[model samples]
Every structure is written in structure tokens, then in C-alpha cells.
Target: MRHILHNVYSYLTRCVFIFIGDITLNENRMLIGYARVSTDEQTLDVQLDYLLKAGCSLVFREKVSGAERDRPELNKLLKKVRRGDVVIVHRLDRLARSTKHLLEITEYLQHKKAGFRSLSEPWADTTSPAGRMILTVFAGIAEFERAQIRERTAAGREHARARGVHMGRPAKLMPSEAVLACRMVTDDGMPVAEVAARFGIHKATLYRILTRRQAMKSTDKSLNKIEKISQTYKCQLYE
Candidate 1:
């Protein structure tokens, strides 16, 4: 029921903006446009016409997937937009692939004191009061989702550590293979590089494994000393 109401409200807001667009589209703001097609083979003529007909003074078109981040044309359009300018897109998906990306682009436009509108998605018009508030709400939701994901990832890493499961890429050499390589380097006096090469691992890996082992040994000694002190204190208390 709540979702249905939201959709109805959005539709009403969209109609209101469409009505507003007819009246004050070209009052003082320039309508700059951006269009995109997923592949180079796809034609952008239809989208271009829509943008131009919608009163866009300038348009930027690109032949790249919406998921791609290295869109030179989009970057140029963003850099060119100024205060009181409005960016127009044929559709919302043409501008962004996900909600997070959409919010980020809209936030950047807001920072530039510009606005955004979509020919097919009137509810996305940033020039309206409700539209600006909607963008702010979307941005806040995206941020909260990101924070939740980060917390979950941290918790998962901690759970994995508690289970003795390594969290990174598997080691290049097995424990038996590493032990043999270490023996060759230490006892037989073979070069570390040669031992690493024999085990199909890098020299740095050999040094890292040895250094980590030494650190663990040091930690064990410190823990043992602390345990002994704890035991002595308990005995004294009992006495």
C-alpha cells in the first residue's frame, strides 16, 4: 500500500513538472542534453531528436555502456554545465546504471547549482521542489546502504578470522611445499630466490611467510609470560 501511494505521488509530481516545463523551460536557464547508447553499433538519432525537440541547446552523445565509468562525453557535459543550467537526458537509464550512480551524478549537478531532467522520467526533474527533496532522500538512502554494506563486510571478515579461514587470495605454495623450500634456504644454504623458484613462488612470498612465522612465535612467548604472571597472582590470592 505504501509503495502504491509512492508511485501515485511520483506520477502526480511528474505531471506537474511536465506542465511547468511547458511554461518556464527557457526563461533564463540553458537546457544542455546528454544521450547514450550501449554499443557503438546502436543509433542515437532518435534520442538526439528528442533532446533537441525538448529545447536542448547543446547535446552530448556517447557510445558506451551505462555501467562504464570512463565516459568522456558525459564528463565533458558535466564540466560544461553551469549554474542555472539544466541537464536533459532521454531516459534515466541512459544517464546511470544504478541508483547509487544516479544519486552521485545528481549530487554533483546540485553542487554545481544545476538541475537534471529526463524526457521519459518527468519525476526526475531536479528543478521542482519535490524533485530536489526526492534527490536528497535518495542520496541519504544510498549512503545508509553503503554504510550497512561496509559494516557487514567487516563483520564477515571477523567471523572468517574466528574460524581460522584466510580472507585473501590463497598462498602460492602449500604448507608442505613451503616447509621444504624454507629447509632448502636455511639448512642447505640455497639462495632464497632459488628456493622460491623451485616452489613456484616469489622471493617476497618466502620472506613474508618466514617473517609472519617469526612474529607469531614472538606473540606466543609474550602470551606465555602473561599467562605465567596471571597464574602466580591467582596462587597468591588463594594463599
Candidate 2:
């Protein structure tokens, strides 16, 4: 009976400690700031002031272009972020190069159970329902833009094909090289594999070239024979 009571008390104490720890962790959750400038000449004073006033405990600063995908300080901040922490940026552009990029970053933060905020754009805050709605709208717009670009590219490719433009990668073997490769295998009595290796092409590719050329020669001979027969019949009638 005493052991059962002791076990119950220990379990209750552990639950209390765990609940208290969660509260402490929540209290310690931090607001982190990120500041960036395109050039060395630009100053981060204003951004720093805003972040400090916004209660950010730490601020990551970088003098790199936001257009660059690999920002060292930004990557470090992202790595250091923890669940329940919020990452604040001076502006949306400081954090992302485009709407698609912004969505990607937010998606990553969402997966980490972190939050995001842009000081200049209230609608970009992920901590609020309204802000999340606005971001969803932005995501939809970015997706539609990507779809339109893909459609235009596909249409352009189709139009090019209709105009007899060869699509995809150019042929690896040139006309003269193909002829030489075929001859090296047939007339020179060389192994097909050896000829293909000398021509820097697969043996299968060499075989395809040979088959196509032979078919063309057969078609040409058949056409020539038909022309000769027609001429002979015309000469007999005239005689």
C-alpha cells in the first residue's frame, strides 16, 4: 500500500514539474530581429532602433543584398530560431527577394512551429489570424503567377515546334560524324562497339544511324527504278 502511494506521489510531482517547465519555456521565448542592407553604404541604425523598441532580445545584421539567396546572418538566425520564437524583419524585402521566396520562408517557419513578422507590413505577421489570411492570399497570387509563366513557356515551345524548330537538346552527333561512324563500322569491317567508341557515341546510337541511312538509300533506288520504267514506256509509244 505504501509503494502504491509513493508511486502516485512521484508521478504527480513529475507532472507538476513538467507543467512548470513548459510555462518557463514559454516565458523565455524570444523575439529575434533580422536587418539587412543592399550595400555597405546603407545604415542599419533605423532598423536596429525599431527592433530594439519592438522588444527583440537579439538582432542579426548583414550588409548583403536581399536579392542574394544565401545570406549568412539570415541563415544563422533561421538556424538559431526555436519553436514559439518570432523572427522579425524591418521590411518584407529585407527578408525575401520575392513573394514566392517570402512564402517559402514562411512555410519553413511554419514547419518549425515558429512565427514571422515584418515591421513595415502588418499583414505579413504570422502570429495573427488576419495576417495569416493575407499571407494565404499572397501565396495564391504567387502560385497563379507561376502557373501563368509555365503556360506561356509551354505555348511558346508548341509554337516553335509548329514552325519546324527542333526542340530539346541539339543532336550530339553531326551529319558528317554520323556518316563517318557508319562507314567505319560497315566498310572498314570494324566492330560496331569499337566504331561507336571511336566516334564517342553509344553503339545503339550508331546502329540507329546506320538503319536510317540504309532506309533512305533503299527509298532512293526504288524512286530511280520507277523513273526509268516510265521513260522506257514513253519511248516505246513514241516509236
Candidate 3:
């Protein structure tokens, strides 16, 4: 019982010391800033200045294409941010090119208990309810735009097919090459792997060429038989 009591006393003393240390430590709220430029011609200085003025303790800048997902500076900024921190950007577009990507990033920050703010888009501050609503609307629009593009592309393909116009890339291998490849494999007793390697083609491509050649040969044979029968009938009628 005395040993147990001693352990409890020590635990309480450690807790008291930890509490005192925490009280002595100065807590400063982190204000992290992220800036991006879509092209080399653009500059991040303006965004950096605005972010600094907006109360950012640290600023991260990236001169890269917006379409690129992996950015070194952006990763570093994300790693540095902690719970109860604020990540500020010059604008919503500066943070992400697409609405979906923007929402994803912001959602991660929300999960981390970090706040998001945009200097240009005042309504993009996640601290307010209105900002969340605006973001939802933007996400819906972005998804709608993507769906419309897909629909138009599909409709265009259907129209082309109805007009008997072939869609997609033209055949890469010529008829002669296909025929030669088939002959080499079937008649010459050459291995498909060797033939493909010799021609600097993939095994799948070689197989497709061989199949096309066989189909063409069968079609040509049928036409030749019909021609011969017609010739014989014409000769019989002349005699």
C-alpha cells in the first residue's frame, strides 16, 4: 500500500510539472501561406506580399503548372501546418485549379483542425458558414462542367459513327505489314515473340496484325472463287 501511494504521488507531481511547463510556454497561432503560379511567365511576388500582409507567419511559393498535382513547396507547407493553424492563399484559384481539388485540400485542412482563408475571395474563409455554402456551389458547377464536356464528346462520336465515318486512331500497321507478319508466323514457322521483337513491336500489336491479315485473306479468297464461277458461266454462254 505504501509503494502504490508513492507511485500515485509521483504521477501527480509529474502532471503538475507538465502543467507548469505548458503554462510557461508561449503559444503563437501559426499562419501558413501558400502561393502558386500556373506558368513561368507569372510571378508569385504579388501573392506573397498579399499573404504576408494578411498575417501569414510563413509563406510557400511554387512556380509550376496548375495541372501538376505534386509540388515540393506545397508539400512542405502542408507538412508544416499544425492543428489550430490557418492556411491562407491569395485566391481560390491560386490554391487549386479545379473546384474538386480545392474542396479536397480544404477538407483535409478541416480534418486537421486547420482553417482556410483566401485573400481575394473573402467568401472562401472556412471559418464562416457562408464560405462553406459558396464552396459547395462551386463544386457543383465544376462537376456540371465536366459532365457536359463528356456528354458532348460522346454525342460527337455517335454522330460520326452514324455518318459511317470511322472514329478513333487509324490503323497503325499497313495491310502489307499485317499480311507479311501473318505469313512469317504461320507459314515460315517463326515464333511470334521473335517476329515481334525483330519488328520492334509489342506482342499484342503483332497478334492484332496477324488476326487482321487472316481476315483479309479469307475475304479475298471468297471474292476470287466468285470471280472464277462468273468467268466459267460467261465462257459457257459464249460457246
Candidate 4:
């Protein structure tokens, strides 16, 4: 009985001195840090130092590109973080490639009831309400920027249309080249492929040009036949 009582007393005594609200030193939950770099030439020392000074007891480090999706250390850190524990990084860019990725990581941590913090971006601390609010502000700014970009792009396109500016890739052949290609195909009896090569145009474009010339010739012949019939009727009426 006395041994059990001594153990209880010692546990309570230590509890009284413990900072219950501080998970970084709570002895159960902890603050974990992650550091990364793109290439072997880059060093993790700077990020590691920041995380250590910020109260992280354990840190995971790796050398990998931000564009790379398979970061073993990062995956392990994400899996290892428990509820009430914090994941600290030197900066947001140190952890994620873009804002979308940053939000994804934070949302995952939030769902797990874990916290995230950036030593460089104090506003990115998810352990408190202020930091979360700051995150909201960032999201709003990103939305506003996208809206502005869309609006400006639409306006610019309208302005370009008003000025009669052509959009998309410019025509491969100019008017003179088109006329020459048609003459080569129709008059000179050159093969469409040979004309296309000589004019630096695609065979498909040459086919279109050839089709247009045939349509124009058919229309011209129809008009001439109509004119000849009208003249013959006038001569019979005079007789």
C-alpha cells in the first residue's frame, strides 16, 4: 500500500509542476519539425536550426525537390504527428510547393487535430485562432487575385477584338504565297504536296486552298452561263 501511495504522490507532484497547456513539453504529445531541400547541393541546416530553436524535440529532414511528390521524410512526419502535437517548419515553401499544397497539408493536419506552424511566417501558425484567421485572409487574397486576373484577361481579349487584332497562331502562308500555291496547283499542274513544300505550308492547308479555288471556279462558270443565256434571249426579242 505504501509503495502504491508513493508512486501516486510522485506522479501528482510532477503533474503540479508541468505546463499542461504546452504540448511542446507535455511529455505525451510533442512538437515535431520537418526540413527539406531540393538538391543535394542545398543544405537542411538552416531549416533544422530554426525548427530546433522553435521548440521542436524531433525533426525529420530530407533532400528532395519541391516538385517531387514522394518525400519519404515528409510522409513519415505527416503520419507520425498525433493529435495535440505540432508540426513545425522553417517556412511554408519549405513544406509545400504551392498554396494549394499548403492548404491540403494544413487541412489534413486539422482533420487529425494536429497543429502546424512556420517559423518564418508567424501568421501561419495553426495552433491559435489568430493564425487561422491569417490563413483565411490569405485564401481571400488568392481568390481576389484570380478574379482580377480573369476579369483583366476577358477585358484584354475584348479590346484586342475591337482593334481587329487576330488571335491564335498566325496564318502559315501570306496572301501572295496562297495565290502562288493555287497557281502552282491549278495552272502549272504541280502536285499539292510539291506546292506545299515549295511554299513552306502543310499539306492539309494546301488541300483547303485547293478546295477554295475549285469552289470559286465553279461559281464563275455558273455566272458566265447565266449571262450568255440572257444575251441570247435579248437577241431573239430584237429579231
- Assess every candidate by TM-score: 0.55, 0.55, 0.46, 0.48
Q: Can you tell me which runs of candidate 2 are displaced by over 4 Å? A: 1-25, 40-42, 161-239
lDDT, residue 223, candidate 3: 32
Better of 1 and 4 by lDDT: 1
Candidates in order have lDDT scores of 0.65, 0.64, 0.61, 0.63
Best by TM-score: 1
Per-residue lDDT of model 2, residues 74-183, tens digit only: 76786678878889988988877766567656755654567788999898887777776666566555545544555676689899999999877324565535644554
Clashes of each: 0, 0, 0, 0
lDDT for each residue of candidate 1 in 1-239, tens digit (9 for 90 to 100)? 35434544554454344323322335688899998998745699999999999999999988887556567787678667776889999999998867856765665565456788889987787888777666656654554555455567768989999999888843575443444444444434556665554344556676666555455675644234323333443333323
lDDT of 3 at 30: 84
Instruction: Report the lDDT tens digits of candidate 3 across residue range 1-239.
Output: 35434544553453233222221112566888998887865577888899889988888988888666567786666556676788899988877756656755664455455678898889897656667556545544544454555467668989999999887643354333443444445544556665554344555666656555445676654334423333443333323
lDDT of 4 by residue, 1-239 (tens): 35434544553443223212233424576889999888955577878788889889999997887767667787678657776888999988888877845754665565456678888888898776678666655544544444455467668889999999776732566433454455445434556665564344556666666566556776654234323333443333323
Weakest ten-residue segment in model 1 by summed lDDT: 15-24
